[model samples]
Target chain A: MNRDTVIPPLNAIFQDVFDDPSLEVSDDMTAPDVEGWDSLSHVNLIVAVEKEFKIRLTTAEVRGLSNVGDFIALISRKAT
Target chain B: MIAQKTASLDYGRLVRESRKLRPDGAHQNIRVAILSDAASQQFVPLLKTLFHENCVNAEIYEGAFDAIELEALNPASGLYEFLPGVIVLANCTQALRSRYYEHKGDDFLETASQRVQRIWDALQRHSSARVIQCNYPLPYERQFGNYDLKVPQSLYSVTAELNSRIALYARQRSNALVCDVEAIASYLGRKHWFDERLWAFSKAFCHLDHLPYLAQSLVEMVLSSMGRVVKCVILDLDNTLWGGVVGDDGPLGIAIGPHGDGEAFYHFQQYILSLKKRGILLAVCSKNNRETAIQPFLENPDMVLKYEDITVFVANWENKAGNIRAIRDTLEIGLDSMVFLDDNPFERNLVRELLPGVIVPELPEDPADYVRAICELNLFETSSFSLEDTARSELYRQEAGRRELQTSFTSIDEYLQSLEMKIEVARFDPAAVPRIAQLIQRSNQFNLTTHRYNEAECETMMRDEANYLPLYARLSDRFGDHGLISVVILNVSAAEMEIRDWLMSCRVLARGVEQYLMTRVVAVALEKGVSRISGHYIPTAKNAMVKDFFAQFGFEKVLETDGGSRWHLDPTAYRPPTIYITEKQRTS
Candidate 1:
C-alpha cells in the first residue's frame, strides 16, 4: 500500500470514528480541527485505523503522530 | 412487544446502535453507576445499547477514574447522589499489575483482596445498590513459564488467586456479585484480549473490540436481578435432540446413544437433563404424530431425558408458534421467559416472526455444535438457587397426576380430599431464608404486594421476632413434596396486625394452600389480641388474577387509591373456611 491508497481509507476511518459522514481530512489537520476527536476518540481512531489497514501501532508510534499527514505516512509504511 | 432478536455483541454495531437510541418512556428506567480503576468512557455507550436491547432505558453515571475508594467511602459523593440501583466496580488487570510491582510485601494477595472487600463494605453501608465486582483477567506474561502455577508471589499466580477470592467472597454477600471477566478473556483467547498500546495511551479496559462482550455480561446480571429470567426451555425432537427423524427411522432405528454418530445427541440430552434438574421446566413441541413423537423416549435404551422428565409434551402437525403459545399458557409464564430450540431454520424464523418475545437461538449447521452454540449465548443467567429449585420439576409432574385424578372424580371437593394434602405453617427458620427470599423475588401473579426483598433483608425480618411474623408454608401430598410453596409476612402493632407481604408459588394455586395460610393468619391475629387485620391489593400487569383476593375472603374495603385498594377485617368475626388440607405436626 502507498500513501495515496492509504489516504482514502484513513479518511473513511476518521469520518466513521467521528461519526461525521461528510468529514474530509487535510494534510495539516489535527485533533482540534475535527469535532468529537478527543483523547478518548483518538483511541477509537487508532483502533479503527489498525483494523482497516491490518497493522498494529506501537505506543511510541501512536503517541508520536502530530497530524493527519503523519498518520497516513505511518500507515503507508507499516501496512505493506 | 419485546424484541426477541438476539442482539449482536459486535463492538462497531453496538456503538452505532447506541448513537441512534431514542428513549422509550414505556420501558423501565434503571440507574447504573460504573466505578472503575481504568477509563470508563468507552464502556458507557456499550452498556446503554445492551440495556436498550433488553427494554430498559439505563441512566448511566461514570465515576471519576481510579476514584473507587474516594467515592465509596464518602457519603455525599456523586455515586450515592446519583441514586443508582446497580454499582459496577470494574478493576482491570493492567492497573493491578502496576500495583503489584509497587507493593513491598509478600502478602500482596491478602492486601489486594482486603482492599476489594473494604470497598464492598463501604458501598453497602452507604447505599442499597447491588455491587457487581469484576475479577481480573490473568496477565499473559508468565515469568516462570509452566512453573508460574507454583510461585505464589508471581503476578500470574496472584491474579488467579485474586479471581478465586473474589468469587468466594461474593458467595457470602447477598448483594454482591462477581462478573467473571477472566472467563470471558480465556474464551476469547488472552493474546487477542490484551492490547497494551491502547492501555498505555488511554487506559482502556481491554481491546475496544472485546468491550461489548464485557458489557453484555454485566447486562445479563443486571437483568436477572430485575427478575427477568428463563424459566422454561422448549425443545424440538428431530435433528435437535437426536441424530435422525424419529418418525422415519423407527424408535429403535434412531441414533441416540453413547457411541458412534449418536454421541452428539446423547451429550445434548445430558445437558438438557441437567437444566431440568436445575428447575427449568422442559417442554417438547414436535411436528410428528403423538404416538410417533414419544416412541423414542419410551423405546430408546440410551435416551437421557426420560418421558417423566418432560412437563408438557405436545406432538401434532401444528405450527410451532401456536404450540409454543399453548406451552406458555399452560406454564403460566411470560413469553419472554421461554427459550425455543429448533435445528430447522424455518421453524426458528417462524417463531421469531410470530411470537416476538420467545428467545429462539439460531442453531448451527452441525449437530455437535448444538451445546456450544447454546452455551455461547448464556441464556440461563439467574440470581438465586435453592433446594426448592431442584424439586420444582417433580412438583410440576405431580401436579399433572393430580389433574388426571381430578377428571376421574365427581366434584372438586372430592378431588381435593382424595389428594390428602398436608400443610406445615411455621415461622421462618434460618434454613428457609434463601427460598423465602427467592419466592419473594420470583412470585409475580399471586403476590399481593410485590416487595422484592433480598436475602439479607429476609434474614433481618426473621430475627425481629417482636415486630414481624414471617411465616413459610410447605405442602406435601401423596404424589410429591412441594417445598416452601407460600410465604406470608405480617407486621404486628398494638392495635392491629397488617399483612405486609403475601405471596405463594403459582404451582400450588387452587389447592387450598392460600386458604390454609389465611386461617393461620387469623388465628395468629386473634392470639396477639389485635382488633382488626388489614391487607392491601396492589395491581400489576400480571397480578390481575388476585384483584378481588381480599373481597373473596369477606374483608370490607376501607380505602381505595390509584396505587391499590386496602381491606380490613374484624379478627373476632372472621370465620375459618372449610379447607381439605390437614396441618402437619412439626417434628422439630
Candidate 2:
C-alpha cells in the first residue's frame, strides 16, 4: 500500500507493456524516457496497472499524470 | 477455427503470442480487410493470433478509422486494392450510440438499414470479397427504461431492430454473413462488455479483455466461408446424453426425460436434435455393448434423439480415440470437421492427445451445465444452409444400409446393380445452384481438384454455356434420394474437353456415380468431335484417396509434378465401364 510495495509491481507492469525486461522506473521518468511508450501502449499500461493493483483509474486521474512519480502516487493512494 | 473455452482466452497471453508469431509456410494465406467505425488497431493482433491458431496465415488490412462507406463505395479504394477474401465490417455499438443521438429523424431505422444494404451492394459490385457484416451490440442506456420495447425510437429499440435487420438482410445474400457481436456481448453480460472509458479515450470497439471473443467469431465466419466446417458431432453415451450408465442402469432405468432427475439430459438431447435437424450428422461413440447402448434410443420414450437420427453409431469396449478414427473413416469427413463430446475427462484427454484435430470440448462436472458448456464454445458455426442439409442425415443412414447390402453380395458389381440406382446428370440449373456450390465447398476426399468455388462463382459457371460444361448429377435408388451428389465442370474447346473440376459427395461413393458420369462425358466428347479428354488430379491432404482416379478411367498420365498430375485420354479409345445406373431423361 506504500511506494515501496507499489513501485516494484508498477515497474514490472511498465516492463511488460513495453516488452522490455531491463526497464526500470524513476520518480522523474516520463513517457519520453521509455521506448514503445506511446498513446496506444499507454492504454495497455493503464489496463495492466489497474489489474495489478486491483484499482480503477478515472479518466481525469489518468490524464492528469505527468510523470512516473505521479503514477506511483496515484497507485499508492488507490491501493490504500 | 476450433472454439476456445473462456478460461483459455487470456488477452495478455494472446497478445504476447501475436508478437512472437512467425509466418508458417504450410499455412494457407488469406487476405482480410477490416473496415470499422471503432479502433481496429487493438483487434488486428487478436485476429492474427486466432487465425494462426487455426493454421491460417492472415494478412489483415485495416481501413482508416470510421471509413466503412467511403472504402466500400469507392471502387479504387485500398480495401479493393488489397483484394481481401473476406471484408469484416465491425460497426461498434458505441459509434452507433453517437449516431443515434445525433439523428433527429422519425425514420432513422429505415435510413440505417438502407445504408448497410448500400455498402453490401457497392462491395459486391466492386470486388468478389465475402462480406462479414457485424451486428450492433445493444447499448446499455435505455431512456424509456422498461418501456424501451414499446418506444420504437429509443436507442435500445433501434439497436435491437438493427440487429434483426442485419440478420434478415444477410440471409438474402449468399456471400454476406452476420458476426452476431450482440450475442457475445449478451453472453458476457452488457455491463462487463462495454468499457466506456476505453471507448472515450481510444475509440476501442469493446473492453480489450473481450476483443478475442469478437475476433474468434469473425474468424469462425471467415473459416466457414473458406469451406472449413464441422460436419459431424461424435457423442458419448452414459452420463453424456443421459444420467448414469445404460449398461448397468438398464435402458428404462436411466434418468432421461422432461421431469425428475432426467430434465438436464432431456434438454441436452433436445439441443443435439436441433443440430441434427440443421444437417450436422450425430454419431454415438459409447463404451458399452452395442445392443445396450442403442436400447435407450429405441425404448426410451423421453429421448429426443432417436435411433435413426444417428448417422454412424459405434458402441464398443475399444479405446475411444481408435473408435473415433473408425468413425471418421466411416463418415469420410476430415477429423478436423468432427467434434467429440465425452463426459469423462479421461476419454476427452485421450481423444485430444491422439487425434489432436478432432474438437473435444470439456464438459462441466454438473449435469445441468452440460448444454451451457457446449453453447459457450459455439462449436457448430456454418455459412451455408440448404434443403440438402436437412436430408443429409437420411442420406448417410441409407449409406449404412448400402454397406449392409454390400456384405450380402460376393461381387461389388452385383451389390451395386442390386440397388437399381437412377442418375440425372445435366447442366447446373438455377434450382440446383445452392446444393452445387455446397458440394464444391464441402467435398474434400473424392474431389479431384479441391477448388472451393463460392455460390457467385458457381452461378457464373452455370451461365457461361459457350465455354463451360458445368454439370451436376443427382442419384436415387430404392432406399432414398441423394440430392445433387456430384459436380463435374468441363472446359470445352474445339481440340479437347478438359475436366476443370470433379467432386462428389462421399455418401454416394462406390455407387458407380463417377463411372456413369465419365461415360456420359466421353459420349459428349465423341459427339462434339473433340479429339481428347483431359483431367487433372490435384493432391491435397484429404484428396489423396483419388490420386489414381484418372488412371482407372484409361486416362494416360501426361505431366507429373509435386503439385499434381495431368491425364489425357483419346475419346475414340475410351472404354466405358459397365454401370448399373439408368440415366433419367432430362426434363429441361
Who wins the lDDT comparison?
Answer: 1
The local lDDT score (0 to 100) that residue B304 gets in candidate 2 is 90
- Cα displacement (angstroms), candidate 1, residue A6, comes to 2.7
Interface RMSD of every candidate?
Answer: 0.8, 1.0
Per-residue CA lDDT of model 1 for B389-420, tens digit only, reads: 98878766677567657768999999999999
Q: What tens-digit string does per-residue lDDT give for candidate 2 at B371-443?
A: 8988878888888899989988987888766765777899988988899998999898888999898888899
Candidate 1, chain A: TM-score against the reference: 0.95
Clashing residue pairs in all predictions, respectively, total 0, 0
Best by DockQ: 1
Which residue pairs does candidate 1 place in steric collision? none
lDDT of 1 at A31: 91
lDDT of 2 at B96: 88
Native contacts matched by each model: 0.79, 0.29
